[model samples]
Target chain A: MIENAFYSQEKHGPYKLFSLGNFELEEGGIIPDCKLAYATHGKLNEKKDNVIIVPTWFSGTSKDYESYIGKGRALDPDEYFIIVINQIGNGLSSSPHNSLPPVSMQSFPKVRIGDDVRAQHRLVTELFGVQEVALVVGGSMGAQQTYEWAVRYPEMVKRAAPIAGTAKNTIHDFLFTQTLIDAITSDPGWNLGEYRSNAEVADGLKRHADIWAVMGFCPEFFNQEKWGLFGVESAEELVEGFLEPFFQMMDPNALLAMAWKWQRGDVSRLADGNLAEALGRIQAKVFVMPIDTDMFFPPTDCEREQQMIPNSELKVIHSLAGHFGLFGGEGPSYHGQIDEHLKALLAVPVSESIVEQ
Target chain B: MIENAFYSQEKHGPYKLFSLGNFELEEGGIIPDCKLAYATHGKLNEKKDNVIIVPTWFSGTSKDYESYIGKGRALDPDEYFIIVINQIGNGLSSSPHNSLPPVSMQSFPKVRIGDDVRAQHRLVTELFGVQEVALVVGGSMGAQQTYEWAVRYPEMVKRAAPIAGTAKNTIHDFLFTQTLIDAITSDPGWNLGEYRSNAEVADGLKRHADIWAVMGFCPEFFNQEKWGLFGVESAEELVEGFLEPFFQMMDPNALLAMAWKWQRGDVSRLADGNLAEALGRIQAKVFVMPIDTDMFFPPTDCEREQQMIPNSELKVIHSLAGHFGLFGGEGPSYHGQIDEHLKALLAVPVSESIVEQ
Candidate 1:
């Protein structure tokens, strides 16, 4: 007899979903109550001074960074309090997919990194009574959020580790994301972003898969192995393999909303009119690690940021894994280099705390 | 008064349309008796040795390049014969927009650079009785066609100049095109790629405009002189300004079809299945010039070709105009460099004549 495996231990996370009360969404739309999904893996010590902020990547949930959080890893839960907050459109949290009708694009709230960090800040301060974070760690879009936390709440974050991220998006990145989003919404079957099943939007998904496969690997990888990633066959098949499980698991509306958020992403917009000044206000020691093979967010873009933030260091990862190599690989794949840097970052003493001005 | 206002200059062009009895287009669809609209400037010399081929840019018509011809310019009609072939789905050419019913995504024939060059070859040999060309020059997608001409019919093309082009598309290019196509076909009003003028489908067009605006200019251009290419104050306004004219200019079906063709473009797919052999077979002298700020076709990609082709030269255009700078304003643009190159190219003895076989 098959046991009810649906309620497995693996599915249970460190934190549960919290209702933040009635909240106005966007475009003159409203949700009677908004729920924020989050997971915390480390214990908060007496002073609550060892917390670290970890935001979700685009299409990634709080579970995505789990590999880096367990025993002996750089962000080992045994040593620090790690808070992983789910961004608005991540399905488990507030999203268009689970929400009721009037579910048009306009109805979806306009969320930036600042908005995400702000909402997450409320959760940390009100519920956990967390005062300051030791570091904010993330990769890709998550890294963008980490940067946002430092800028938006200078007093709350003591250090930031933004990996494979950008200061201001290059035209190429904007074009890439815009295209991916367009592919999904353009399907006649999409019915104006209303189609939620894989059946209706299969073509769009296939096209989306094709684009993703290319961005997730390096040119050298393509030259050597064609389209195979680890051991996949074709670019289409790779995306298919990934999306088959992912699309079914995800809320399509949440995916759509997150895509909309990604397209509008620009931390430079929040520079209080001056980007350099905003970056300067980042009291946290910033560590910008851009992956060399990451076509989505090139290392040069990170190098550009290294120059802007005064107490920042750039750690370039050399791997053919592209954007995802930051998390999904072995110790040698990225850890050795990252560990070396983290050890150095950990050694640096936290200077001048944010005195309540 | 109207007659005097519009000088009816002698229609000196043999700008005839080629009628295909029963040919398929590039969108997995067929067009019975398809006709390709084209314009020819300059006179075919007695021996037809002064022929120059100019393929149209993406979203551009044969008419857009008309100004570059005539008495002056590098492609002076007074000096050589110039052929401007309208790519399939440019409205005037046989496209889903104007075709009979069943105008959907599956209606277009899958076409690559080989198909385009092959058709142009027939037009040149059978229609114009042109045995050889002095030069084939094109920018962007047009450049891809020019490269195909050199690879497919090495003996026919004496010289080739591909500006802001790549030997093979990078994954980045693939993803961008994939996304653009997705945006066009995803709208519910798209009616499975059948929607012609539906308002819902118009949103896809807006998305396309948003993406297109990002690539059309450099960040410096947007930062320094925000003249608003699409006219609105901000990025959203800019997207609005762009889509307003863009969508109205062509049928959505045609755009989708065109994009499909572009996505399938691969010059290596031509010849006897060996890409290296195809590159080696190009007996024509080649000049591959990539613009420094060209976000779509990066310079490093073009440099890849420099290592492959034997009798080839790589020229880098340092311009802030991005892709368009390959065909832009005054002295520093690609036009100036192209003019100098053309003068040099004109002086080089035809490749066939260089070493009499």
Candidate 2:
């Protein structure tokens, strides 16, 4: 079988793998040898107080962060040491695509958002000897990790900006994620995660892209013929150019693994299913940013969750791009709002002494 | 090949077939012979003025309307001669599953919402010699036909109730329908719609069910564990009992055909791409009813279209069951509201004089 270039670290990034030796998953599974692929930019200050961790979203790699992390951007690598940690099951990391026999695609253990955070924590503290995270910010599944970081390690994370994600995966979201996973798995080519090549599951990936086209953007995005902005004339062209090619590059099992984690994202799992209690544990200065027209994570949902987080502020980003607004691919319109907010968030003075909430 | 019981009209209904020797589609396709399966309740009065026409929804048959039609119900069979016409491509009717070669399975031509209405118009006028329809009522895709019938043959339809559907398919609805169709076609067992048995595409059907579980109902319906009322212990059971089995019985290509019609449901095609002009042509006493919590057809979307129909009333059904609230299956709690509104709609006197709007 031809090796898939989509999973290769050399093509997508300047990622370095940190082996965890043996890692136990939160959901009672263990990987004999687990490794996390990550990329670092700029320089770590002498005091080690300039660290800002950005976890990768589903199907995204560390390389994809370049647009969001440059000079004068929200995550300016010139000023802060920006570490982009690729989430597990994203192919680059120790995932279904690259894991060994015991934890390979067919037997890969179920992972949680907490597991990714735990792995990132080990990489930050062990490899770089970082005592605290100056800020943790990301969008979509990255936003999921940002919330996990704030709730799991309150003392270590000083500030967090979770955009287009939630503290808990809503029932609506869980169902959507399940359908996405099922779409890939139902493909005969999947063969229960034992496909010989990515070509086998091409149809599944295409279908997965179709689902994203529907759910990923605001209705006006299509009704207003916004695909023209992306150099596409029709809905069919939008799917062909944007959605299909994007998802088709990734491994189906890897996408399924990440979707499973996304479906089970709930900080409250640590607090015995008490969401309010889980949210109350956060000590980070929270900026809960949600896109206004996002069908997946609506402002109403984000605002409700924000009200539960005692020290959190809700900032609604208005854009027709919906969940993709955070990526700023539609235009520079949303990037300006995001950069302004992050600058303000970084300006807030951190407390000298860390205390448990 | 084993005969599929699901496609047999004898086992599931009291349906009678009406053959349209040769039928042409709006989208430049022709079926050598077209047949529509339909069921009728009550008796045609001496004057034939007590006629109420009901069309089947997507994947639905005439038998499925039993719950919504009965004595003293919204569609009381005792008071009117109700003709429940199965939409073309719903298996029992002229569908991808039941049609002969040239228009069967792999070769079935694309159908539109207008085509189904056109077929129904022939059955109503030519077969029954019906001069006027006292009322035309239906939900979901049935509602789509209700709108088409009113707009296409304004003089024949005196009253119309289109519930949980819109005059023109919204961009969001079109996208959702596309995802659903893709889900089935992506299945390897589908073999481009030539699958040997229903078992071949079971996974695709299950995934389709999962999508419906998310978009078909309000989030509160699942969040509050309202499925418990149906005697299901968990969400898994709800999927097993309600969603999975409900869709598993239908043919994939048939569902795809209906979904294509649903995605392209635009009466504006008749008015040269003006939705308001198409809706403005309705001479019926229109009742535009939409469920409050329906994610697919939200009250906001329904209300906007309702405004376009110059002489129409918007009655929002407040129920957490969402789109399924129209089915009256949420323990009959929502049935009372639907009954009340439908009764009110029925009570409105039909004007004797018909004037072009």
The sequence of per-residue lDDT tens digits that candidate 1 reaches over residues A18-64 is 67776554334455466778898879999988887888887777877
Instruction: Sort candidate 1 into its docking category.
Output: incorrect
Clashes of 1: 22
lDDT of 2 at A195: 91
List of chain A TM-scores, every candidate:
0.88, 0.96
Worst 10 residues of 2 chain B by lDDT: B1-10
Residue B309 CA displacement from its true place in model 1, Å = 1.6
iRMS of each prediction in angstroms?
Answer: 4.5, 2.2
Top-lDDT candidate index: 2
Backbone clashes counted, model 2: 0
Question: What does candidate 2's lDDT look like per residue over A318-347, in tens digits?
Answer: 787778776577666778788888999998
- Pairs of residues at least 3 apart in sequence or in different chains that clash in candidate 2: none
